[model samples]
Structure formats: structure tokens, C-alpha cells
Target: MSFISIKNVWKYYDDNLVLERLNLDVEQGEFVSMVGASGCGKSTFLNMLLGRELPTKGTIVLDGETLKDEPNADRGIVFQKYSVFPHLTVLQNVMIADEFSSAKVLGWTFGNNKKLIKEKALEFIQAVGLTPAVAKYPHELSGGMQQRLAIAQALMKAPKVLLLDEPFGALDPGIRNDMHELIHDVWQKNKLTIFMVTHDIKEGFELGSRLWVFDKLRDDPQAPNAYGAQVTFDLPLAERVNKNNVNEIIEKVSRN
Candidate 1:
């Protein structure tokens, strides 16, 4: 079975259908990048994967079992806005994520495991190239640095799946490139499945081995809410043309 599966899924907010007849199979440790226009159900898709929302029809399965309607430690998420605590130091933020997850699973504080927590937190901080900023507060760090913290905090829990919602969308060009490398590096070492949502097709194609393009392909003018977004293409980058050609392919996909 696929590590993550979405079969005949449809999502609707009240009467507004957002995603329709969506089926996907994500292998473990594969990076799947998603691209689409705004309000095209990308965020809704991620929310469903993370178990924050359930599909109105069909199933979302992980490891043969259907998902529950609540967030769990098996999945970690990082948004465009840093979700780190403003009052906590970088190290503390990373430490708490691990503690929180463990507390949920073990039904007790990992407080006794503080010594190990500090060690693991530091390891993830350095993994994201933030060893120096460990002592600084969130506000004390630059935007890129804060993002690094967010990545570290998420991965510190060692989640099976990581969901990134345009985590680098707000960064400067230089910093965005840096984050791309950091994310790839962490993905390599952590061996976690990833589903990232991005507006930039170049970024999507660059980051993932499999690319899923989402767009509204069919609509009725009389009833705009009746139709919903669906995958236009699922392009595997393992055997493909060069970078420019790959971008060209996605450009064509986006246009159609």
C-alpha cells in the first residue's frame, strides 16, 4: 500500500465544492510538490492530509487506516508565517515541539528527558544551520533564521510526514534559495514524506521528484460552485527534460 493515499476525495465548505474526485498515492520518503493558483484547494488539500479537516466524500488513508479528525504527531506542518513562539528562545521552541508530541503519545511529561531533549533539539537546530541562533528569541532573528527555526522545530519531532504551506513564499530571493537547500538537506537526512504547496511552479518542480498540478478544469457558468479543482497533471521528474524544459512543461500545464 502507498504510505499516504487519497481516494475519490471531495471537499466542500458548506455548498462550495473545492476539491473533487482527487486520488493520490504518495510513497514513503517521496517529495511531492503541488502548484496551483490561489483558492484552488491546495491549502484545503493539505489541511485534509494533516487531519485538520475531513473530506466530505471518500477517504484519506495513511498506512491502511483512515485518518482521524484531529492533528497528530505523525504529521508536522510549517506555514509561511513562522509558528514559533515569540517569547521563547530558539532552542526552547524546538524543545517544546518534541516535548509536546511525546506528552501526547506517552501520556506523561518528557520532562525527565530534558537532557536528551536538549541534545536532540540542538541536533535539529544545527541541521537547519541555526546552531548560533539557538540562544536568540524569535524576534531577535532574521526572517530566514526564524524560518530555519520553524523547520527545525517541526523536524525535531521526527514526523512521518511534513507539510509545508509556502514556507519560503515571503522570504527574500537569496534566502529562498538557501531555504530550498536546507529543506532538501533535511529531507535527505530525515527520510520523511513531504507535501509542499507553492504558487511558484519553478520551486515545485525543483523540490519534488513527483509534481501534482491542481487547477479547475471544468466549470459551469450557471453554477460556479458545482465544479471543483482537480489534478491537471502528475509529472514525475525522475526521467524528464532539462530544467528549462521542465519549467516549460509546468508553464504549459498552468496555462491550460
Candidate 2:
């Protein structure tokens, strides 16, 4: 069985259909990159995987069971915008993730528990190369540094799946390249199943083991929302294949 199964899924907000017939199976440790035009429901699909949203018609299964209709520590997400606490230091921001999981009511830990969480947070901070800014608040950090902090916070949960919604979209070209390397290292070191939505086709090809293109197979001009988008292409980025056809894949993704 697949590690994550999305079978015959469809999403709707009222009468506006968003996704139609999204059937795909994702294996563990596979880095799947999603690309498509804006408003094509890429983020919505990621939300379903994270359990923040439910399919209006179908179901999403994770680890052999149906996914719950709520967010949990099993899945972590980092958005394009920094999802950090502005009031907290870098260390505190990462530590709070564990606190929320361990001490739900208080959202804080004490004594040995606090010490362990702090140590773990520090480890992740270092892994993301943010140890220098451990004491700085979000407002004091650069865009790339803030995003790194966000990545550290997500990894603090040790999630089975990592969902990234254009996590590097806001960074400068140099900073974005650095982030790409960092994420690649993190994914390999942790053996994480990652689904990233990217507008950059080149980034998608460079980072993902597999690529998915979401596009509308049918369109009704009279009623735009009458039909929704689906997976128009699924490409496996094998080393040789990717090296040989990078431009071809980019062209295909860009045409839609």
C-alpha cells in the first residue's frame, strides 16, 4: 500500500468546484513538487494532506488510515510568509512547538522537560544555520533567516510529512539558492515525505524526486467553476531523465 493515498478526491467551497478526481499515491521519503497556474488548488491539496481541510466528496488516507479532518504533529507546514512568533526569540519560537504538543493547556514546559525541548530546538536551529540568531526576535531577522526559523519550527515536531507552500518564493535569488540546498539536506537527513508547491518550474525539477502538474482538463466558459482542475501530468525525476529533459519538463509545466 502507498504511504499516503489520495483517491478520487474532490474539493468544493459551496457550489464552486476547486479540485476534481485527484487520485495519487505518495510513498514515504518522496519529495513531490506541485506546480500549476494560480488558483488551481495546489495549496488546497496541501491543506487536505495536512488535515486542515477535507475533501467535499472524497477521502485522503495517510499511513494506511483515513486522514483526520484536523491538523496534528504528524504533518508540518511552512508557508511563503514567515510563520514565526514575532514576540519570541528564534530559540523560543522553535521550543514552543514542542511545548504545545507536550503541555497543551499551558503551552509551556518546566525543569527537565524545558531543558530537553530547548536542546532539541537548538539542534534544529543549528541544522538550519540559525544558531547565530538564536536570541534574536523575528523582526530582527532577514527574510531568509526568518524562513529558516520557520523551517526549524516545523522540523521541531518531527513530522512524518512536510508540506511547503512556496516556502522560498519571497527570498532573493541568492537566498533562495541557499534555501534549496538547506531543504535538500533536511529532507535527506530526516528521510521526510515532502510535498512542495512552487511557481518556479526550475526549482521544482531541481528539488523533487517526482513532479505533479495540476491543470484543468475541462473548462466551461459559461460557468467557469463548473469543472475543476486535476493532475494533468505526473513526472518522475530520475537522475538521468531529469538531467536530459529538464527543459522539456519546464516547458510542459509552463505551458499550463
Q: Best by TM-score, which number?
A: 2
Candidate 2 to truth, TM: 0.97
Give per-residue CA lDDT, model 1, range 166-195, as digits (tens): 999999999999999999888888888999
Residue 201 alpha-carbon offset, candidate 1, angstroms = 0.5
Q: Clash totals for all models, in order?
A: 0, 0
How much is the lDDT of residue 112 in candidate 1? 58
lDDT of 2 by residue, 1-256 (tens): 9999898999999989999999899999999999999999999999899898989988898898899889998999999999999999999999997898789999999999999999999999999999999999999999999999999999999999999999999999999999999999999999999999999888988899999999999999999999999999999987725466778768767887
Candidate 2 lDDT at 44 equals: 94
- Taking all chains together, the TM-score of candidate 1 against the true structure is 0.94
Model 1 worst lDDT window (10 residues): 103-112
lDDT of 1 at 143: 95
Give the poorly placed runs of model 2, Cα more than 4 Å off: none
Q: What is the C-alpha lDDT of each candidate?
A: 0.88, 0.93
lDDT for residue 132 in candidate 1, whole number 0-100 = 82
